[model samples]
Structures are given as structure tokens and as C-alpha cells.
Target: MANHGPSYGLSRELEKKNQARFSLDEAIEVLLWVENVTQLPYSCDPTTCQNAADVADLLKDGVHLCKLINRLLNNGSRAPFNPKPKMPFQKMENISNFLEACKAYGVAEISCFQTVDLYENKQCYKVIECLRSLAAVQLIMSGFEMESIIWLWKLATSCEI
Candidate 1:
């Protein structure tokens, strides 16, 4: 019998594809856009950075990206034409999988774990920060938050988790 856990090869391939599709320059631009949308600080500039700082910035962005993904999965709005919507479990699952992949690929840092813990533990300010950070990322990733807004609304109104 074969073990049926998530496919490590598939995950790595997906991560590689994602990285190929979005280069560091593109990621930086996305991060800056997210920052502007969410009114957060844009901490990194692609033009000037040491390797360590670059890694740190990428990790920080990864944390923000995770939060945004969670918000989109949990409470984002929907597409205008999606009249009969399915649950967002798939999207949530995708985000979780992607985060795990990021960790595996060494793109995510230790601070991400700390941030996750802080959010889960109900550290009030940290939670708010997390939300803001995520919102920014979602705004960048989703192209105007249409999907996020709808998903969030559906999650709020639907009783059929």
C-alpha cells in the first residue's frame, strides 16, 4: 500500500513553479502594493539589500502573505456572479498548503511561526497587525479584493461550514 499523505514532489514542483512565475522583483512590487493598500510600512527595497536582509524581508512578506490568505479564506467577499457558492475550504486548504510549502522551501522564517502563535493565542495587537498585513497582501494578490470580500461575506452568513 502506498502512503497517501500530501505529495512532497508535487508540493516542491508547485513551489518551484510559483517561484518561477513570480520573481523577487515582482514579489517586492506586490509587497509594496499590499503595504500601500493596507497602510502598513513598506520595509524593503529591492535596490539596496544585503542577502540576510533580503531573506528577512522575504520571510516577513511570507508571514503577511499567510495572514492575507487566511483572511481571504475565512472572511473575504465573493465574486459578483457566484450566485450559488461552495464553501471556501478549498481556498483555505490551498493557502495552508502553500504556507507549508514555503516553509519547506526555506522561504518562510522563524518569525512566521512566532506571528502565527501570537495570532492564535489572541494577542490583541498582534492579531490586528496580522489582519492588516494580510489584507494588504490579499489586495495585491487578488486584484482588488473582489474574491476576498465575497468569500468573507459568505463565510459570515453561511451556517453550513
Candidate 2:
């Protein structure tokens, strides 16, 4: 439970290796893509990470994540949950809800991440992978041909919110 970075320089090398997998740029792109697909009541900007505790801070509450799942699952017109989470446990519940929604939407279990990954600010790449997978699923369902899949992902990554 003590994931506040390396305790000392002894683990710095290992920490750096792990940090290399967390792509802040990719995370932002995923967040922006989710934002573009859903009709969020809140204007949670993904680019505010310069002051955020974690890249997933904007999604820490899990409200938008649920919305993203709802959108991906073709439930964009309705809310999967109604909790206005403020407590830590509530935030965790939202994350859990998002994961459940992912499973329901046919996302591979391997692509889904654990709650602590986002809640504790760890393993951000997992979150991005899940989001990208969801986006791909959404795009493919929307009639994108097989050849366009690669280009679609590149387009989504290059797109700005």
C-alpha cells in the first residue's frame, strides 16, 4: 500500500523502468477521445495534468469513466451510475463500475486494469489500453473497415479534444 514512489534510490531504477510504460501523452489522448464521444455534464479537462496529482485525476471520481463505458456500450443516452462520489471508497466504486461496464461491453479481461491502478496513480498504461480498445471496438462497430483500423487509432491519437 506504500506506492508513493521509491522509498529510496535503491528502487529508483526499477521505478524508472515502470514509469517508462506510463504514457502521459497517450493517457491524455484516451481521455480526450472519451470526452468527445460522451456528453459529459462536467467539463473535466484532460490537459490540466500540469497541476493534477495523477494523469487519471480527472477520472479519479470515475464519473466520466462510467460515462465513457456507457458511451462505448451504446448506452450514451443514459447514465450507468448516479453516484456523485466524493469519498475515497465512492471513487473506488465508480472505478469498479467502469470495469464492470468494460466487461459487459466485451473488453478482454487482460485489457482491463485494477482499481488501484488509477486510484493510486499507478499502471496508467493499462487504463490507456482499455480506453483504446474501447475506442477501437466503437469504431469497428460504427462501420470502419479492417484496413482503416490502424488509421483510425492514429487519427484518434492525433486528434485534440
Candidate 3:
């Protein structure tokens, strides 16, 4: 018998990666478009840094949501983070199309557009930022770093309610 946990996951993951064959540049561009059109506070520029680091940064900024909730719980009125410009309806629709393209291109199985309520939930923008960051890693990350990238994905996907 052999250890099956990591090996099984790795094989499954490799199969999935092989099936999804989009270029790194394509993934990055779509993600960047989502970030820019949403006017998210965090940057999702793939040209500047590693995907894991970018995801970490977005997650760090997301901590403010907890601070914000705490302030509200304490009856404080001030906003915890600066407000971002509203993403126009046209731009939001465009982002949905871009995400669809990402999926159609087999870049990654992204579904944030389906669950995100862009009109009401501000946290959704941060989620999009994280998703875009993760999308950047699909083709570029090395075998040695895949575990860390998965951890980053888990962190990025969990949005505190």
C-alpha cells in the first residue's frame, strides 16, 4: 500500500491542469480587467508580482471587513476602509462576460460572478480580486509551490460572513 492523500490529490490536480490549457497572459488579462472595472482597492496586476503574494495582500486587506463589523457592533459610525468608486452596470456586465471567457477558455473554474451581488455586497469586489489573483497562478506556479498556492486559494475563497 502507498500513501494516497497527497499523491491522489496531485494526480487529480495534474489531470485538471492538463485539461485546462489557456495561456498565462490570457488569464492575467481577464483577471486584470475584472479588477480594473470593479475599481477594487487591491491591485491584481500579474506583471508586477507572484500570484500567491497578490492573494495574500488581498486577504490582508479583507481583514478590514472584520474591523468594520466590530465597529458597527460597538456602535461606531466611521467606515473602516475607504470607499471605492461604483462600478458601472455596463462594466459589471463586461466583467461577467470576461469571467465566462475565462471559464470557456479552460483557464479555471471560476464562479464568483454567479454568487457575487455587485450592487449590494461590497465584499464581492475583494472576492473578485482574489479570484483573479488565483487565476494568475494556474499555469505559472511550479510543482514545489502548488501546495502553497492551494492554501492561498483556500484563504482567498473564504469570505467572512
Candidate 4:
């Protein structure tokens, strides 16, 4: 009812001929050939033609051929390749409206309601100004010459406001 047999055999001659089909250089050459044929201009020449007439002719013909190739490659369908879909104008308008509402609610004034809050808000514009002010106060508290604090204050204020 059943027969079992050796399904296959490779002779020494066949074994020697059945090598891996492609070398690394051959694979690279094939890829390069495909890339060259598929790319715009399709010419192997890397340099732009120097003659004005030749350059103009090449550009004219190249543009037409590129369009033809692109049509064929895309099967006459053009699809955008954007990674992110565009947001609707309505959504952006809503965000702007929200921010305007917050501003109208005096959210900005909350940032500078107290002395500490005022200092915190002010330092956000320039850390060097804050550091100089702190260093001056420390020097004054440590009984350093008052001239140093005054000099630092003058130096800090001299910068563009």
C-alpha cells in the first residue's frame, strides 16, 4: 500500500556545480544597475554637461523622459508621501481660540503676582541677569565692598534690555 524510497541524491558532479548563485560584487552591480535605470535623468554621467546647447537639450528631454518614467513607475497614479496627515484649519483655529481665552483670563498676570513670582518670571528671560543679582546680594550680605555690587549692577544693566 505504501512505498518508501530515497527521495533525492546529489552526485559529486552536480554537487560541485550547485554553488551559491551570486557573489557580493554581482549583487551590488545588479542593485546599482536597477537604481541607475530607475533614477531621474537615467544617465550614468555624474557631471552636468558643460556645453550650453547640450545642457539645454538634455534638460528638456530629461524632464519629459522623467515624467514618462514616473507615470509608468506609479502606474499613472500620484499619491502624496507625507509622513503626517495635515491638521484641519478648524483644529488650529480652536487651539488659537483657547490660548486667546486664557490670555483674556489674565493667565499672564498670574506669572508675576508676588515678588518671588515676579523674580521667577523676570529670570526666565536671562539667567545671567539673575545670577549677577544673586551674587551681588550675597556679596553685600557677606560685607564685601559695596563698590563691587554697584559695579556688577552697572555691568548687568549695560547689556541690551
Candidate 5:
């Protein structure tokens, strides 16, 4: 059986605490950047998203995510991993590969979301955090200011504004 979430008492309160940290605007930004970077196959207009749930739905399959990472790493059309996985296990495999690539691309292990996180909407904020980390690392590698990125990370993780 799958753990949907706690339904009562202290555990429920803790579960509620884990909710609502994600920003729709930042998620849109990440989606736009991904669309721009990978030219996603479908009509991806992230601006239309009303909430983080929408973003989660878009990325649940992990195909676009794989393509985004592939474009960043290879800068070509060749897909070394399975580009389109039909089964649940295969899709999870793609997400796993994507996580591994992000780690290899300088995203720390602690900063990454587990496959189930994105797949099951367990903690969607971590997905944005991983993407934000990837963007920061990529920018730093390309000679961007590290201090600014640090500030952004701090701002992102901090409580309220």
C-alpha cells in the first residue's frame, strides 16, 4: 500500500507543515527555462499554470525533464538514455537517470529530490530546489557571479520573503 499522508493528529500537523513552500512564480520560471532549453515536444506554456500541482502534473512523466538534462549535458539531439519510457518503472528509471546527471553536473546529493518526490508529489519543493541548484551551478560554471546565486538560494530557502 502507498502512503498517501497522515490523516490526523501530530503526524497530520507535521504533514501540513511540509506543504505550501513552493512558489508558483519560481516554478513557472523553472518551467520556462526548461522549455527554452529543451524545446519540449508538447505545447508547454508554463505561464498558464495556476499552481504547483499543475507543474507537478506536467513533470510527472519525467520525459521533458530528461530532455532538459540531455540538452544541458550533450547539447545535441542524441539521447543516450531512454528518451520515452512507457511503463511506470521505465519512467522512474528516467527520473533516476536525470537525478544522477544533475549530481554529476554539480548538484549536491543533499539538494536533490528522490525519484518518488517528483513522481508521487511527496515533496515538490525539492524538485524546484534541484532545478534551481542546477541553474545556479550551470551559471557559476559559465562565469556568473557566485554571490548573487548564493543570495538567491538563501532567499529561496528562507522563511517568507
Candidate 6:
């Protein structure tokens, strides 16, 4: 039984719109909204409603995944969340290596590689950047703000007024 939840589908949809972009601030606002909504007592169980609290957790997890990607790009192979050095390889020198480390760190371990391969062509540095754009659009689209589509385009092109 595979979990083709909203987060999973949204991640894939975002990958297809790789060239798209959105305002980081607005994206954060939506994420906060998601968190608040999920915290409500009426929130449905994750097994039944993907958009329920599960989506919020997934969004937060996505951000954490991005942080790990950035850290790997900057720190040169060391796992950002792992401090014990218990793993055989401490550094992620390439995309495959980074994905493996992510699996070890339990970041969507089962589908982590699929997500990475979809956005990055073995480029660790670009992983977070790509994910950031994808996440922004996903959040905005979910918010039903069609007019903001132009805003996303502008943000992607220049991030300037």
C-alpha cells in the first residue's frame, strides 16, 4: 500500500514546474496557516486526510530537508543532523552520496532519492534552491490565489520590483 498523499503528489507537481517560483514570505505564511489548521481539533487523521495535519508535518519536513541539502552543499559532506559520526561516510561528496546520507538521516528515506533526482541532476547545491521554488508555488497554488501566478513568475525571474 503506497501512500500517494497530498505532499507526495504536490512534490511531484512542483518538480514539473521547476522553472516556476514564488515569494518566500508568502510561502511561509501559507505554511503557518497549514500548521494552524492542522492543529485544530477537527483535523482529520493522516490516514484519511492527506491535507490534514499530515500535510503540515510534511511541509515542515520539506523545509528541514532543504536545510539539510544546504548544509551538505556548504559543509562538504558532513551530515547536518548527525553529530555522532556513527555513519561510515561523514561527507556527501555527490548527489548520490547525499541522497544516501538523507536516507540514513530518515528524510523521507523511502522516496528521498526519487525526490532529489527529480529536482537535481546530481547537483547538491541546487537541491535546496530548486525545492524552495517548488515549495513556494505549491503553497500558493494550494491557497487558491490564481492572481498570484504572475507574482510567482516575477519572483522566479528577478525577485525584484
Best by TM-score: 5
TM-score of each: 0.28, 0.76, 0.28, 0.17, 0.79, 0.23
Per-residue alpha-carbon lDDT of candidate 5 for residues 120-150, written as tens digits (9 for 90 to 100): 7777888998988888677657666433444
Which regions in candidate 4 have their CA more than 4 angstroms from the true location? 1-8, 11-16, 40-161
**C-alpha root-mean-square deviation, each candidate:** 16.5, 5.4, 17.7, 34.3, 4.8, 18.0
Residue 99 deviation, candidate 3, in Å?
1.3
Q: Ten-residue segment with the worst summed lDDT in candidate 3? A: 63-72
Indicate the worst ten consecutive residues by lDDT in candidate 1. Answer: 77-86
lDDT of model 3, residue 112: 42
Give per-residue CA lDDT, model 4, range 1-161, as digits (tens).
Answer: 02334335575444334222213332232223323444643343324333222222222222322232233232343222222214433333332332233233333423222222112221121212222333344344446643444445565567775
Q: How well does candidate 4 score on lDDT at residue 143?
A: 61
Best by lDDT: 5
> Candidate 4 at residue 51, lDDT?
28
Better of 2 and 5 by TM-score: 5
In the range 1-161, model 2's lDDT, one tens digit per residue, is 33473456758765566678877767776676667767664455677655224566777788888877776565544435645876888888889988887777777888898998888766766777877777776776777643344435686678778
Off by over 4 Å in 1: 1-22, 46-56, 60-62, 70-161
Which portions of model 2 show Cα errors greater than 4 Å?
A: 1-5, 8-11, 41-44, 75-80, 145-152, 155-161
lDDT (CA) per prediction? 0.39, 0.71, 0.39, 0.31, 0.75, 0.38
The local lDDT score (0 to 100) that residue 64 gets in candidate 5 is 83
The clash count of every prediction, one per candidate, is: 14, 0, 0, 0, 0, 2
Cand. 4 Cα-lDDT: 0.31
Model 2 clashes, total count: 0
lDDT-best of 2 and 3: 2
